[model samples]
Structure formats: C-alpha cells, structure tokens
Target: MLTWAVRMRRTRQFAWLYATTWRVAIPGMIAFPRKPIGITAHGREVVVPSGLLKLLMKVVLGRATQVFAVSRYTRDVMRDRKVISPQTGVVNWNGLSGDAANWHIRSTSSDDNTQLFTICRLVPRKNVRGAIEAIALLRRQNRLGNCRYIIAGRGEDETALRNLVAQHNLEDVIQLVGYRTDEEVTAYFQSTDVFVHPQIVLKDGADFEGFGLVVAEAMSYGIPVIAGRDGGTADFVQNGQNGILVDGHAIPEIADAIEQLVQSPKRRNQLGSSGRHWVSENLSWSKHAKKILVGLSSA
Candidate 1:
C-alpha cells in the first residue's frame, strides 16, 4: 500500500502495515498552514501521534516494498523531515500528452519580429505584474520595439493586471487573451518566440513552481524560457544554458534576459535545442511513467 501525506498528523491516521511495498510521495512543501491539509478533525487540529507516525513510516521504509518521491525538493524535504529514508527513489513529474494539431513546432520568428507570449493565471502569486513591469522597463530603456505581450489566462487578479497595463499606457503592447482552451494555449505557444513564468513567493510564506508545465510545453516546441528561480523551475531551466532563471523580483534582470533572447537568433536556437534535449531526457511523461512503474513493480 502507498500513501501520500502533506503533514505528520495525517501520516498517523493512515497507519497500516502491508506485506507489499509502500510508498509515500510528498509533492509540495512540508510547511505548516501555508499549505493546509484539506481534512480537519473534530473542530480541533488533526494530528497523528508522533510514535505511531514513526512506526508506520518505518514499516513502509523497512519491510514494505519501494518508496518514491516526485521532485528533488520534495525528496530533500522528506529526508530533512525524516518522513522517508534516504534510500527512497525520487521521480520528477512529466509532460502531458500533446493534442494532434498543436504537436508540431511552428516557426517562432517573423518578418516583423514583434510578439511575446506568457500563459498563466492572473493571481498575485503568479507575478503577472512582474512580467508587465519587465515589459514597461524594457520600453522605457528603448530596448523593446513593436512587440506585443500576449498574456493568456484568467483569475481574480485579471482586473488588477489589466489596470496595471493600461496605467502604464501599454494598451497597444499588452493584450489579455483571457482563459483559453488547451488548443488555444498550444496555438499561443506555437506563435510566440519566448515563454516567461515570473513566479514569486507569496506573503503567507508559501512558495510554488513545483515544475512549471508551461516551460516544458514551450521546450517541446523549441521555445526558450525566461523564468524565475522559484522552487522547481531550476530543475528544467539551467541558467544561461537551456533558458534564463532570474531572481523573482529583479525587473532589470528579466528585461535583460528578454532583450538577449530577442536580439540573438542563434542564441535563442541554441537555448531552445538545449531545452528540448533536457525535456526529452528528464521531463517527458514517458520517462516519468517508466520510473513510477519501476518503483511500483519493485514495491
């Protein structure tokens, strides 16, 4: 039997010993209420007794079968938290299946050469404001010309983000395409030159980016990425190799990375190739499925 737990408390509730191997995978951070456990207990805090939790974990690790994790960050957390033994195997999450029409790579460059793309919900944590600010900064420096920023996604912060764009007089440069179907998103990916994911840590002490699937999608089509070093984004984007990883709040750094990719076609091509190679080897669904199968079979 295998179980996944976000907190030590729940680990105690699902206490069962199995002759078969057991696995416990933690997908995100082990932080407290920052990432809450969905279930509550008796109007009080739900928790596992420490002793029982430890015993169950030992049974899974020692006698059961195999253990697996989702990401290096998660694996490290498990080790540090002593939730799982050091011997547990870790597997990164993989890509989704591509739709037929959206599978082919489109030519990223254009005769006019003036379109950028970003696809993310307009939530504050997504840092859409940062992406817009980067565009504004680039324009102020005269580093950007005739380019349009196409942001496609819908969320609570949509109004605020659009207001920011209009406030900056970026009405012509920024376009909010709103929530798109998967096919539409793939079309946007096909049309754009670069993909940017400017994620930042939230005020609640919660950090995200447990592998940005958009980055992988862009790479599959040979588009380079400019993402923040938020959590697991680093697993896909190697600095100055496959793509650029900027400090989350660094507007100038983001602008500079965008400018570099825009100005050099050769560099963009090289980065795109590197990104595709990395995805095939490390981020593909097939690769991840194979790893999971191996762990499950052994368990």
Candidate 2:
C-alpha cells in the first residue's frame, strides 16, 4: 500500500513485499494466487471465473513495483498469466529458519518401525488420496514390513480419506491423525523416517502446491522426501539425489518409491543425508532474504 511503503521508507527499512498468492500480491503493491475464488466484490462474495481472474491478474500485477515469487514455477505462472513481466518478477526460494540438527530435540520411536509421514492440508491438490492409495497397495502386496503411514493435518478431505482407508482395510497401515500443533508436527518429524507427499496441480491449474515447506522441514531432520515430479516441489527435490520425485497421479509409482525406501535403509539414509545437506547449503532464511535484497538493488 502507499502508506505501507511510506511507513517502511520513514523507518529507513526496505519496502519490498513478499507474496505467495496473487490475491495478496496484487493488493500489496497497492497490499498483496490461490485462484482467489469466491472473493468479495462490491461487498458481495462471488466466484471469479478463470478468464476474469486472468484479466485481473494482468491489471493488478502490472502496477507492481516489483514481485518476488517463492519458486521458479511460481514466477513462470505469474509470467504466463501476464501478471508480471520478466523485469518485475523473480524467484526467491524458501529456506529454513535455523540450523537443521538444532530442530530435532524430541525423543521418539527408537524402535525399528519405519514411520512414513506427511503433513499438509487434506486437499485433492495435495494428493493425500494418492498417498493413501499407495499405502493401501503396498499393504495389500505385503511390501511394507512393520512401517505405518501417518498423515497429519486437518482438511476438507479428512472424511473421504478416512473412508478410503477403511475401504482398503488399511486401518492398521495408515492413520489419519488430524490437525497437529507446530510442536507436535516437529515431534512427528523427529520420529518420521521418510516423508511422502507427491502433490499435484489441478487440471485447471487453479490450485496447486506453491512450495512444500514441509518437504524442506523433513529434509532438515535428515529425512528423505518423496514429492511429485511437477510443481515447485521439483525446484528443491532432485530425483535420486536428495529426494525421490514421482508422478502424483500414479499410485503404482508412489508405492514403488515407498517400497524402495522401506526395503533398503541404505538408500533411505543416502537420500536423507543428501537432502539435509542441500537444505543447509541452499535453504536458509538468511539466503532467502539476501536474494531479495540483492535482486532489489539491481532492479
């Protein structure tokens, strides 16, 4: 906003705005993209069709002084929607707040049971169903040894996910433990062996995971991540290097990746160690901030 920018200026602080969604980003240059469906207009909430949303994006981001997206895929989407030009837009990857090892302070699951986990809103775009199907498939085939999959988070799909789990008789294999506190999530990460979240983009491209902070958080704990081959997740998860990337829609592939990790602890350790190193080297709050400052100086 004019006052927001002025306030920062009066305080001699950088006035740049950080945006993860288009709705907020557009107003921020004014205040601050998740489709922005059912938004209020003229004091009445209404759904915004794809065409008009595109036009609004063009008009709104056009006025922005500068825009820093969370990932390269995000910047590309903004460019494709004509929201921001190559000159106005840039990608600044997310980073961890502090040291990696400093995060794992909880004692949990000292047993040999490999705990597979994922924490995200229970949404279709998150592909939690796909993960469930994969777990069910693995259980049916007796591929998973003593491992159990834990989905932590609350969402609209909670009921449906629970139904699917029951349908597969995987009640013992997969447990959907709804919404958890930040501390609880960290404790889950401490006990987690491999993090699986092969998320996807909707066909309309209206909904998708912008960036998977949970994936980075898992990596920080030296846990290997299994994410979708598409979306911003690919920006950080390199296949077979630090983490495994799979087709989110393919349940077989997801099962195969999970089975690979379960069967071979060596592979799991390799990926987890490399993932932690990558997070330490590439992802940090300091690095994220510096990228913005350096880019803003040049812009």
lDDT of 1 by residue, 234-258 (tens): 7678899998899878888888888
**RMSD (CA, Å), each prediction:** 8.9, 5.9
Q: What is the C-alpha lDDT of each candidate?
A: 0.65, 0.75
- Cα error, residue 44 of model 2, in Å, equals 22
Over the stretch 1-299, how does candidate 2's per-residue lDDT look in tens digits? Answer: 56764574457443445544456555445422222111111100111235787677556555444566777776676556455566656667888887765766324458888889989989888899999899888887888788889999989999999999999998887898898998888888888888999998885664666678888888888898999976778889999999999999999999999999988778988998899888888988888778766765565
State which candidate has the highest TM-score: 2
Clashing pairs in 2: 1-30, 21-33, 22-33, 24-32, 25-32, 26-32, 27-31, 27-32, 28-31, 28-32
The residue pairs found clashing in candidate 1 are: 9-48, 21-64, 21-65
Cα-based lDDT at residue 294, candidate 1? 61
Best by lDDT: 2
How many Å off is the CA of 118 in candidate 1?
1.0
